[model samples]
Target: MHQSFISYKNFKSLKGSVVLCAAVLGLYVVAEPSATSAGGTWLGYVGGCLGGVLMVWLACLGIRKRKYKNTELLAVGWVSTHIYLGTALLLVVSLHSGFHLGLNIHSLAYAFTVMVILTGFYGLYAYSIYPDKITLNRDGMSRDSMFAEITEIDEKSLALSEKISPEMFAKISENVEETKIKTSLLTRLFSDRSLKEGAIYKAIDFVREQHSGSELIKELDSLLQEKESLVGKIERDIRYHFRLGWWLYLHVPLTVGALLSLLIHVYVVLFYW
Candidate 1:
């Protein structure tokens, strides 16, 4: 296992180095005065070249890594390199443009690169922070297990409700059904209405009127307390996903945009030069 880890580490490092080297070489070639002598356009060439090379390198690294192996450390390092190099590409390309943007395909491509980089940066932040956030948010409970516990609680609740007023039992049943559908993080977080609050209020009002002196009221009260705790857990789960969702929206589009811009840059350089 140690040897395997070492091999994976070395492979990841070598892959990163190749990409870095290609980026540097591409920038150097573009910065050469010969290609832009008449127009002083070396900066744009250098920036575009560097950006394009980095994009290709990133793509190659992803494909190669996916095909050969899965290593957590290597994955982390690759992601770190991707983020920093993406940022550097933005700086290099922006400088290459001499900070002049206009209404043209070249400028549009540049804009797309910036958009890609910025979105990637957001994704990196999410990637770095989310696992910890998820752990903390879970409060030592596995989300799946938490739902299972809730299900068990629902079963207990239904049993106890049978001893109570029929109306109160029906209300508990409704709440249980609603809660079951809201097992996922996204559903809990984005739910516009509060299921627990609604349930609790209805239960309280019904108990005060219909079953004030019974043993069933006491059991119903205990179930209400359990429901409240479960609701809080679900809320935390939802919030976790809400934070994670932003990264997906940003990362995916930016990745696609970067590829498109890189292609445009490559085609322009090859054909126009």
Candidate 2:
């Protein structure tokens, strides 16, 4: 025989919540009847409030369930409910506002909420895409190995500098110091235009005039090899950084905008309404 058990707490929590939400929505619809409501019709307000409450409740449920057990299941449930209800909220809130947006705090709050939802959608897309990119990159490379590769190139570059003109050697040294050729994604992509390409072109032109076996030619050749490797690493790093960074750019600003709008909305509803 199989024994089965269930948590009364979870059942109680769910049941109490549904009752409370229904009651609140019912009250909003039936109590204190408005003769000429500007915001929305009583039915529209009821529907919107009910939908918002349900969505918020589902999100909270997702959080609470994850804390107990079956995190993956909870996460999936949470994301699904979040996306579906967030989309619903867009419609609900729009109807709740009755499509009348004036220069007021409530309108501002509504606008902010829309902005936050849009950014959040973009963030979801980013989260889904970036992990694949990170996995692809880490398939054969580790962070320490990438650093080691750069160090190897640097050593080669230093050796090559030995046969170059003193001025060229000094310039190379200055460039290296100014740009600490790390495997950082941001530094790799944005800083690539500054030094390596120009240096390689100049070095190639200068070295070609010298005999193949000469010290100047050998130094330049070694420098060219190292530069090519560094460029490749930097390119990959930039791609990785960009893959993750763009979402943050969208999500963070919108969140801040939402909070500001919420504050304005609360102030208007409390004092003006």
Candidate 3:
């Protein structure tokens, strides 16, 4: 199985960012502020510039992903750095705001900036987890191959059921049908296998044990069980996709909000201050 991204390498970025934040904090502590102790001061303005630069760099991660792959560009290393630096940007931006907010465009801009960072942290978490799970569960086979196996198993099971007694055929037919069909969204989202796979397995097991002497029943039971396993993993991979991809749905909009807030902040500050 492939490993998760929660290794020492990813955390190394956190260590570096922590050190940088600590040094910045030390400087901020020593630098005496004006009477207001706001972003109008020297350190506060420096923090503002640093935060703005980090925000732009964080956005460039998208470009990094698109432009650099399959080369010696260290894409994985870049992503880890992106996450950690984005984390540190939170502290920097908060320092820039100087624990002071007014009921104006400045506060609104700060709110959206925080929103962008929060969503990014969530995306970071998803990246660290979902990919490994999906990779391990998929084994070596593609989803299409797994599905083709299921389809072939279903056809064989149906044809075999016809040779049995009518009463047995009717009961086994339901099991085959339930095991072969495509899963529902509710099933994919949550563990709804109990009602579907569980019910069919229960009935099939009872029938298989009652007529244990038949070779076809034994083979059919084993085949159906295999199909059940394959389908379960396919659904699990689908869930992992949902978990990973859903973060972008929130992150993209928040990024746009942050950029708009930035533009407004720039125009207002330039015009007034």
Candidate 4:
């Protein structure tokens, strides 16, 4: 129930951002660079240097995860600082550019930085929300446990189906097929909602009409309902698991692109200046 991202870690980072913004503004006010905070000016260089340093440090988060690959830097503080400082980096870089971007590689770097920051925001939002959903959906049953439950349901449903007519056996087979074992991520998440809904309703109607009549139908209906429930649980588990992970697909790639562009930005500014 408690999400760490919104707590003391981010609060400290927010405090740091406030102080940093004040410093950037105070320097700009006092020094008063010509025409703008041009990169050549002392204040301008300060901004660019600060922004560049922040970007490089931000890149360290990736290294920390890969290299450390453990709880060493995996604290809430590291991640929250990374997120908050990343937001601050955008502002610092904008100041560094003196709000003057154009059709140059420098501007391309700016665009990439913006993309990275935007994706970070998305990742933050995703992390804040999705973990809770995944945990709740899991409800203490791990994915392997869910699979095991499904396997047991399969055996029971098949045994029960053998006592029924061919028509009912085919119905059970079709219902089992709806579980959909090998689906792409998007298809697993969104493709079969209506289909599952329709199937649940039809199964409910089947149980109501037939379960009270024939003993065979009654037993088959119980097995059918159990299988349907297991399938629903499995699908939810799949959907939420994907939700927790899919943000990284976009966030990490954009981050690497931003870092590459950032390197180019540094090299060009240093040599060209």
Candidate 2 lDDT at 14 equals 36
lDDT of 3 by residue, 5-30 (tens): 34436478779889979977887788
> lDDT tens digits, residues 84-115, model 1?
66666765666666656688666777787777
Best by lDDT: 3
Off by over 4 Å in 3: 1-16, 69-72, 166-199, 202-206, 209-212
- For candidate 2, the 10 contiguous residues with the lowest summed lDDT are 1-10
Q: In order, what lDDT does every prediction score? A: 0.64, 0.56, 0.74, 0.72
For each of the candidates, give the backbone clash count.
1, 0, 0, 0
Residues 104-169 of candidate 2: C-alpha lDDT, one tens digit per residue: 777776776676567667656656665566667555676567667756755666566655667656
TM-score of 4: 0.84
Per-residue error for 270 in candidate 3, Å, reads: 1.8
Question: What RMSD, rounded to one decimal, does every model reach?
Answer: 6.0, 8.9, 3.7, 3.3
Say which prediction, candidate 1 or candidate 2, comes out ahead on lDDT.
Answer: 1
Task: After the best TM-score superposition of candidate 2, give how far the Cα of residue 78 lies from its true spot, in angstroms.
Answer: 3.3
Point to the candidate with the largest TM-score.
4
